[model samples]
Target: MLLCSLVAIIPLLYSVDAEQSLSANGKVLELDESNFDLAISAFDFILVDFYAPWCGHCKRLSPQLDEAAPTLSSLKEPIVIAKVNADKFTRLARKYDIDGFPTLKVFMHGVPVEYKGPRKADLLVRYLKKFVAPDVSVLDSDSAISNFVEASGPHFPIFIGFGLNESMISKLAEKYKKKAWFSVAKDFSEDIMVSYDFDKVPALVSLHPSYNEQSIFYGPFEVEFLEDFIKQNLFPLVLPINQDTLKTLKDDERKIVLTFVEDETEESSKKIIKLLKAAASANRDLVFGYVGIKQWEDFTETFEANKKTPLPKMVIWDGDEEYFSVIGSERIDEEDQATQISRFLEGYKEGKTIKKRISGPSFLGFINSLIGIRTVYMIVFIVAVVMIIQTINKDDEEPPGVGTREQGDNASSSVSEAESKEYRSGEKED
Candidate 1:
């Protein structure tokens, strides 16, 4: 009987494995509450999309995930792509705090982190590959170095140390592994040095390929300076403000010297960015970013910018609810833009700027809320429910008349019971 039971379990276990393999075969798996836990547990790294079937964005993302699934699953350290119909599995949705549809999270060893990377097929693959990549990739040749940078994609900053020992950057690499990519090229030529714009070997070069920028540091390689350089170069010299880049700023503590232009594509705007880049290089203590009024009217409005405002207006934002604008350097002339920008920084450093609160809710509030309209609905509904409950509880706790002692005791007992039940319900939900 025992032998027969073992034989029965063997095929059952094999069939379960076969089922999982079939679901993951060259396509994203459609998961639900029943199988979500098991599927997540089976993979070392899985990218899960919490989506609603009726969501237009989710519909659009489905095919992209299908196109990327095969390539990602074929990697040496395979990454499985899966999705859950969050609308159908509401409990699972709430468990993961899915306030919006088409939410993406990458689960590594059963721990999930929000996926803020791109959603396009090719970009998604490149971004997910970074999660599984080693902290510091060792490049043995110039060809390897080139290939590594090419494969690193354009999203994250790349720090490559030429002719430097791996031990020097190992700890730093491990520390900032999530924020940027780190590597050391053991073999390279002078061509590499010229390509990276570094004067000598034993130098660390930080590349922001997406921004068409690079910076070199010939350092003592001490933890303080190296870490400082890495943190400062983690972002481009002049970051272009957009929905995607806004999310990246949440972790940075630096104040932004943000410029607002009429239109980013205009040559005039490019000149402003060039000047801003120079200012940024000199003042590494602050972050410099720019957004076009026409490009993002809503965000510009927060800074009290509008059509009547001078084009290429500048301000120093504290990345929260307030910003500073220098009095004399309020507007930059077309010809004297460079001089005006210098004056703006000088005035700011010398306390010649006025501070004012941003006109609207924080920019990061929108980012944290994830999807816009639906999240607003959820928040409104939650607040309404809480208000109603509080009103009811308040009515129950109203003081009894002086003569109604027994009635007051009865009311207190009922209120205590209700509170106990509410607490128990919260415990069960948790």
Candidate 2:
């Protein structure tokens, strides 16, 4: 009977395994080692999911990808969704350097770029849609430029390429589309070019309509040079310290001069920010950032600035060295705050400034960090010792019993009375 049941179950399990290899909805292409290169090269944009059959995350993502396929296929330039079983094709997985299951890579022009965005179908579709549109829009006349600017909000900066075409500026536009709007013009009116101070062809100009600020780059059209020019001129001199801004600051090797203000909109904070802007302009090597003390109390405490520390305090955090120095508020609040900051920068460069390590919430934080997970063991040990001591102290007390001789005498008198009453009853009966 057992052999017969095993034979029946074996065929059922085999059928189930065969069905697992089939597509969820026949939308995504299953490419193996033999056809991987051909499929990737055929599509201009292809998102490949390198996954393993046994991976639970891969199983969950498969349905989402299946649902997203129809939407992705409706784009102007459709993106193909492909999957590779990394476990089955070890060599192909190693070729793409697949270290984990369900690795999504976006391939464009046969080049693979790792996709790090959200895993949701809607987000994936939206992210892939950006690739469908031409990166650089061609603006033929002055009216076109104006219309484009009007269409896009004032929040987006405009990068205009004069005497350039889409191909010349496409890569730059694609790289910075999320940051700014890119446009190209083959020819512009002399007045327009002169207004932007455009002296050469293939020039890149960043225009900020809201701030009435414009920056022009007339040098080489190399990626690194253009990126540096845009980044340097795009952001404000003084930046707010938040997660995004902190990431940008940490990416560079510059010393960050950050000010912690109690209230961001207060007059004092604004004044200090203005002063820091001047200092930043004079010293381009240092980055200036500010944070509201109340909103980011935990961030301030990372630098050991607690309630005891003065407000609007400036601290220089050296990312490379992993140390910081607190600039005196008196110096920061002085009439010549910029000069004081400049001198502080010089002192820091000359190694005359004192450096301090990043602090934690309390002294226990240091011990806890040093001990790591053993801190939990230490806590449990201490609690056990305390409980044992309490139990021993409790047991040392006398057990409850007859506490006074007067109570004992009362008990004895009651017993004697009862005995006498019984004896008198017996005598009466006799």
Candidate 3:
């Protein structure tokens, strides 16, 4: 009987879905005193909704909690929901000081912050936002859009596609505010959109004022993208050296070493810059300059989107004659980069051979491309192969028979008397 219950497990899994978990569309995982530590440790953010099975408020709030679950889950470190049975784990009530049913205590990253009673979906979203900044913007008018566009510059540069309603630009400006000089074409005319030809709203255009290599993004952007761009692009090494300054050097003399990086997190961005700086110091002719992709994206609407690209990208445009770049996988190893930079500058002064790497996607685009198209193809192919093999194997297996003809010769007992009409009819009379 127990083995029979396990036979249809695949069918059971296929039938399960969103409705199984309360009214709210959330993946509700149960928790109590025994697994409290495990729940807390498993996720960076834990929201424990403590309740009694008999409580009316818990039922009323279940759907609302489910509604807010998705919004909270979208943050960098996702929040896990833990439902606790206060009746069974009475100690938990005393621990959290159970004054009421439907108590929610957010934990992880140290001490628990508790809130008693139930809440609406919006309110719950608001509460979660206080802890983790969600990707959302307040866009209502022209002034708001203009301010964000202009403000993006000192913060980096601004990239505003003019012609768009103030609300749309406001949204984009609020997002990519940290990395690029603002680029705009407000009229929505062909001159702006056609010349740039972007389908997404409030696109970004990156600009490296020094190298003259502008980067552009023709899609919606976020603060996270800008944050990363600022960190990656603005290094003293990538800082544009003035052409006038280079005239001071001998004729066949100077080599520029430029390192490119995305707008990565603060910690990682700074570490890479420090390493690049050391390498640049050892080489005399190579001038190191850093340009954040986000910073340059102020003109993203104009940057013109290219699907293929790579990270921590570097390009050396040797005084208008040749520009060499490399962009496959990012190593950031000092010696490797130093050797590459030296090679690129070889022959000039035992200059390094800088592999001219080009046409790689931005980190975000690269990831999206990897997960979206490539992952889908792999999943489909694997599933198709598995299903085909299963069908072939089932066909190869012979059927088992519980009863046979030829009764003791077996036919005598198997076929009945009266022209064997009884047995023939029972076997469905051919």
**Which candidate ranks first by TM-score, i.e. highest?**
1
Please write out the lDDT profile of model 1 over residues 1-430, one tens digit for every residue: 9999999999789659755564556688878876788888888889999887666677788899999999999988899999998878989887887766678999999999888888889999999999899988999988999999999989899999998889999999988877899999999888887888888778999998888899999998898999999999999999999877887898899999999999999999998899999999999999999999898887898898878898778999998778999998887889878888999999999999899988755444444344543455555556556655765566577755533555445655656565443322221000
Global lDDT of each model? 0.83, 0.68, 0.48
Residue 229, candidate 2: C-alpha displacement in angstroms: 1.7
**lDDT at 301, model 1:** 83
lDDT of 2: 0.68
Spell out the clash pairs found in candidate 2: none
Go through the candidates in order and give the C-alpha RMSD of each one to the true structure: 8.5, 19.1, 23.5
Model 2 segments beyond 4 Å from truth?
1-137, 143-158, 164-183, 190-202, 207-214, 220-224, 231-235, 326-331, 362-430
Q: Once model 3 is optimally superposed onto the true structure by TM-score, how far is the C-alpha of residue 158 displaced, in angstroms?
A: 24
- Winning model by lDDT: 1
lDDT of 2 by residue, 1-430 (tens): 9999999999788656544543323379888876677677677888899887866678788888988888887677888888999878989877886655577888888988766545678767765665555678888888887776665545556788887667766776777665567888865788887778877777888877665657777878777887777666555577778634454554466678878777788887788887777777767667778888676666677776666776556668875325656343323554666667676677667766557777676534323323332233446456555655654555455354434344445555655564443322211000
* Tens-digit lDDT string for candidate 3 (1-430): 8787787675575334322432222466676675666556556677888776766667787788777787777666676666898757978777776544556788856458654222777666644544442222333445555454433323233344443344544544444332233334443444444444455556654434333333445434455564343333332333433222232222333456555555534555556666666666455346665545554532111122122335455555464334553343232444455565444444335433354422333433323222333243345456555655654555456353323211123333322242233212111000
Off by over 4 Å in 1: 1-23, 360-375, 382-430
Model 1 scores a C-alpha lDDT of 0.83
Better of 1 and 2 by TM-score: 1
